[model samples]
Target: MKYAILTADEPFISLAELKSLLNNENNIYYFSGIAVFSGDYKNIARRSSNIKAIGEVLAISNDPKDINEVIRGKCFTIKPNVILRSDKDRFNALYSTATKGVIFSKKCETLDLIFTDGIIIAGLREEERDSKSLLLHAKKPYSQSGTMDAYTSRLMVNLANPKKTVFDPFVGVGSILIESAWIGYTCLGADIDINMLEKTKYNLKYFGYTCDLLQSNIATNCIKKTDAIVTDPPYGKSVNAKTIKIEELYEKLFSISSEILSKNGRLVFATDAKYDWRDKIKEYNLSIIGIHFIYLHKSLSRAIYVVQKR
Candidate 1:
């Protein structure tokens, strides 16, 4: 069995990202902050932005006594969930007695002990996300006011489950394309504004990444069939929404995405949560995989949708 520790702030989105990327796996159980499943999940920790850690499940039990046996001679440190705070002292004592290495010392692995839904899950750490890399957003050469942070952009790209090519019709500053290209995908991007396309090219080149850029409106352009479509369309601003209404832009997006995506390909996009898009999805013959909402502030929230071809 495998386990993943998801980001706390956007747990549902994290779970959706995991499911979309690991569609072939069987999820045995999951809650807000953790998931236990069985699958051939290798390098998933690095591939995902929301998953904090991914590793093999060492043991699971209701009794805390079993931990002593599990940690015998193991050079590891125990990390418990917030729910297990009351038992922290007890867990510490057990670890002190059973562990072969000093706590917090080098070469000591981390053991994730989470209590969720009346079960205790123990997972040994194998891989973890590089939290420092999230700071790359501010370091990027070109960014507009609403440019997505690196973590969120990477999460959206992973949700699309791109196998080869990733197309972003509304490539604003190339946030999505940067992540897709970084993941070794053949990236294709289009924008109605030639200036935005130039900024995307400059920003991508800053990272030594390359992508096909086109200065064509998504509503009229016909892109070659791509394995996935991951994009963040214009919201409602001069820097973003350009001439079209948000509603009409989304309608065009759905129409073009349906025509350009290959069979079984996925479409992952973000939009304002105020508009209802379920009907448009059905009309476009797309199957809904998941929808997650993130509130940015008191007045704004973004809805991310992941859908696959029917």
Candidate 2:
């Protein structure tokens, strides 16, 4: 079906994540903050919170009479498709008459009107944006260094789209795992710090999420293969101590990752792009499919890499 999507401020990252989740590029079109595509985007409402809404296009406005013509019909549904009004005076004038027999409410419904550059598309609501309640719960119970925003974690995990199980090799306080479970994926969290693991358990139970958590450093543990991996490792430009270690740290790291990550399995992880990750992934035959640069501030920026084992 043809659908229009409203995206967030940092649309590039969210759009990339959405495209990866859709696993399609054809029939997908981009606008200022909207994406028009023909495919199964129904699952999108369930997957990511970044997408504001998805709907079928009913009507578009280019001619002056479009709004007047729609108003003339005078038949609106009980669960009416809202007017995603772009012009204030025009909407107020329409509102004065449109609600003459139509019901209106403040709550969110499934379908509504979308106005893109004076074009009006009427869409049946597929999914309202996922709630941030779970994210809020996660933040309240845990405090740590370099905490990824709940939304970013959700977007990253959605890109992975792990089925059966999702693993976080460097699951610090299990923030990513919480987002995974929110999207209905069984999660396993591993961290070298036992204290962090214990904290993860605390946070998980606080949110009533049952997760398999262990304290195993990636450098030492022989990890059993997992369906997918999404992690944000706490590290500097490089973990090397003397003049930056020569691929030793990442070689060992990706070696273990290759052992644990299943064939064709998806992985999403974050890192400073200046590291030796490319060489390390080359050794393990892992290929990066999507990479987005996230700007944190003037001095610091990071890259999120989406990977698949070849």
Candidate 3:
């Protein structure tokens, strides 16, 4: 069935994250801010961090009357939500039909009435979640000083779409792994630092989730590759790869990844280094599908890369 994915505040990143979670399925079409795609219910029903809402396409037009009239024929015992593009006022010739339903009840359906770029679409909503509460719960009292936030970590795991298991080569304080485990993915993490691994253990226990974390070098990963990998490796800050050539470190990373990742397995990671490694990725039989840059400050920025074995 065709579905509509409502994007978050940052439309670009949200759209990219959603597309990746959909396994890079670019059958997506956009008229208004809503993104439309086709997928089975089992694949689409799973909760995703980037998807604000899901709906079935009902009609596409500039006039609200056209949308409202379409909904009128298929009456709902429940009043589905009437959400508009950018929360626009729901009116114009279809006021009577659009205003015929109750809200804030046990009803689970939604009507996405959006207007953007001179187009409007009406869709039947399926699911919605409380992102704020989830984030608040993730922001536990215990946190690493420079580790990635749980929200971004969750986004990365979501983008990777780990099926049976997920791994992290450099799981500092278990930020990504914690989020991955919470999402019900069998998680495994490795780090060269013993202290960090201990902290990771406590962090996972704090969240009432357990993960397999070991103290191992990235160049020699003991854990077998699984469905997906999400990690944040140190690039230039403390514990940087200064003892060895940065190029060599990256080479080993991709090489081991190529060996460990199963077919169709995804590896999503972030680094601060600004270098073109397309040739290196190709050498390892991997292809980079998506990359996003987060500008944190004037001196530093993070580049997120999503790649899969070719």
Candidate 4:
């Protein structure tokens, strides 16, 4: 069994991302902030933005015998969770269970156990998220007023379930492309403005990456096939779409994506919550897999849509 301790913020998006990347979705159980599921734990953890820690589940049972079997003769520590936080008696009982043939010290602990949903889950933490690297959006070599943040960029790419290649039609400063390349994908980016393409190139080069860059419009039909199309198109006054309206741009994107994307390929993009593209999506024979909303403030909310070609 595998386990993932997810971040508490916007957990629905985290769940959607985990579900998209992992198989055997039916068996996945989420309790509190932890997710118990079956998949490639290392692959999912490396690409994940919301998963804090992931590893194998050694023991999962309410009975102390099950817990004792794993903790005995091992140096471990018990991490507090929602259950133990509110119930002191439960924490004491758990501490007593770990003291049997076990040396418990915070500094000397080699393994960790978390009690949640009336059960103790003990495991060897294989990977922990790099909090500093995930917040390095501002430190990029090139950035503009409206460049997407690193966390959201990685989340959008993961929602696409990308295999080998990821394409971003409106690759402003290569936000999506940067995250995709970092996650071991062949990145391809295109934008109508030559200046923006140059900025993307400079930023990607700073990170020691070289991706295929093109100066073209979103309506272009000559682009090569890609496994996933992940982008954040021009939106609001911060971005200027000179040639076509935003609605028309999405329609063209949906139309072109249906033709160029590989079989069952995903087109993951973000737009304002006010815009409705269901009609356009249907007209292009695409299927809507998921839509997650992130509220910016009282007046604005961003809608992320995950659509796949049939």
Candidate 5:
């Protein structure tokens, strides 16, 4: 079956990556992409066509029902195979495709419509309920630098063992921590900002996640060692001046990470700067496992690193 996995903003790259991730399936062919809120739809359409060569074009709106008309028309000439909806629009889209039973929904906030033999698959929200709500609320008022969406967190939990404890040293608003807890992992979160710590506490409680929150900086605090460390650290742009210098911040992060991370433990983190993090990994003697590039906005491409303690 030709499956389309919708990705976050500027999804072309993510779609390609998802295709590679799903490379085991010989029948899957990533045909096209549907973009939302992007002003350059013409350019995206042109790019999509250039990439897929013979794919259809569809403009996605806030309403899922609107897509039905386009899909029914087979405007792309490719039959409706399966629709992978983003987490943000999953609920409404799911309602729209309630009758379809073969749908496969990836835990992401982007939509990917797949075309198998012209049959749409059914989708169910897989991430824990409590975690999704908490992360949504946090992104509203105060923005974190390199935060993961609820679907990404769900994917992370699915990729890793949920039974293992996950720690977030720079747990801004506790999005990752709460999500980890919701997925049945013992979570530990710490932050330097008192306000963020307080918010993290409230959000965790709101999500009914019985996790630990520490008010110490990742640079100076003594946090418990864990099986995994999943964090979105402060980038040069979003952090305070004292913590903005890339070299200094990374130095501190390495120090703290080295101290608390257990032997062979996993550390998954993201950053948006142009720094050479590979050097830091080598300097710290950490084992590089995998790296993913996620385009957050038009200009920002976050580098997500999955490293293991040596």
Candidate 6:
């Protein structure tokens, strides 16, 4: 079906992730703080002939009144193709005259909304209640930004095809690992910090995941051959060791990942440091597939690199 995946502000990064997830000819729309019509969205449609642009901006809001205002006067010709509710906003309600006055209330907040034929059809929400069921909650830590919201994680995991085992070397809190396990893949997680490793174990246990958890440095760890490696390395600002420099860390990561990653296997990770990771990837004989920039905070922009064994 022809559809678009909507992303929030600092969309460069989110758009990258969305592109990885969608991985198709559909349109991708971006906005700043949730407004319908933005220049970026139009650009996306223009750049990708497969996509069509339609502007109807909405933000993640808890206030019912604010949500009502966001959609109250907004025109809907046939209800909506989909209505995605994010965890940040829980007031999910949809109306369509063609469906005999149908209304739906999803369990989680919506992060992405998809509409078609002037009716809400798809709504992406945070999987807080049965978060364990959501594949994204697997190896993610409990930290605010370390974890992917249930909706996005689910979408990514669904898009990813894991023929062999999946490994996360920098599994902070095991969010990605847990998600991989939930999706019926044998997964492994490794972290240098014992404390973070313990936390990952605790969170995985809490979520009832029994994946392999190891304590080892990514640079020197003995990793198994695997299908893919997906991770969110330390941003080098708050979580990483204060003593080590970011450049040194990247060098170590390149050396270790190149040694352990299997041929044809993919490596996907995000980093805020603007060091030339492309050069490092080439040095390691890895083929660069894509690089996406995601905005985490106001000033921090993370570059998510996707590469494969050469």
- RMSD of every candidate to native, in Å, equals 2.7, 4.3, 3.6, 2.5, 12.0, 10.6
- Which 10 successive residues of model 3 have the least lDDT summed? 77-86
lDDT of each: 0.79, 0.68, 0.71, 0.81, 0.53, 0.54
- TM-scores of the models, in the order given: 0.90, 0.80, 0.83, 0.90, 0.57, 0.59
- Show the lowest summed lDDT stretch of 10 residues, model 2: 76-85
Better of 1 and 2 by lDDT: 1
Please tell me which model should have the higher TM-score, number 1 or number 3: 1
| Tens-digit lDDT string for candidate 4 (1-310) | 7888777777778888888888447979987778888755566776788877788888788776777887788766546444336655785687566447876777764455767767777776777766666676547988877678898899999899877999999998998988888888998999988999999999898888779999998878757688999989887775457756888888889988998899999999999898888778979989999889998877668999999999
Q: Who is ahead in lDDT, 3 or 6?
A: 3
Q: Which 10-residue window in model 1 sums to the lowest lDDT?
A: 93-102
RMSD of 3: 3.6
Give a tens-digit lDDT track for model 1, residues 1-310.
8888888887877787788778754655785478888876777778678988888888777665575467665666667674345656655554444333335545677888776655567778888876665666447888878788788889998888877999999888999888888778999999888999999999999888999999888778567699999988877454244556777888888888788899989889888788679988889989888788888877778888888887
Q: Count the backbone clashes (under 3 Å) in each candidate.
A: 0, 4, 1, 0, 14, 38
In model 2, the runs with Cα more than 4 Å from the true position are 2-4, 64-112, 117-119, 237-247
Which residues of candidate 6, in runs, are more than 4 Å off? 1-78, 81-160, 239-242
What TM-score quantifies how close candidate 2 is to the native fold? Answer: 0.80
Candidate 1 global CA lDDT score: 0.79
Model 2, global lDDT: 0.68
Candidate 1's C-alpha runs over 4 A off are 83-105, 238-242
lDDT of 3 at 197: 88
- lDDT of model 3, residue 58: 75
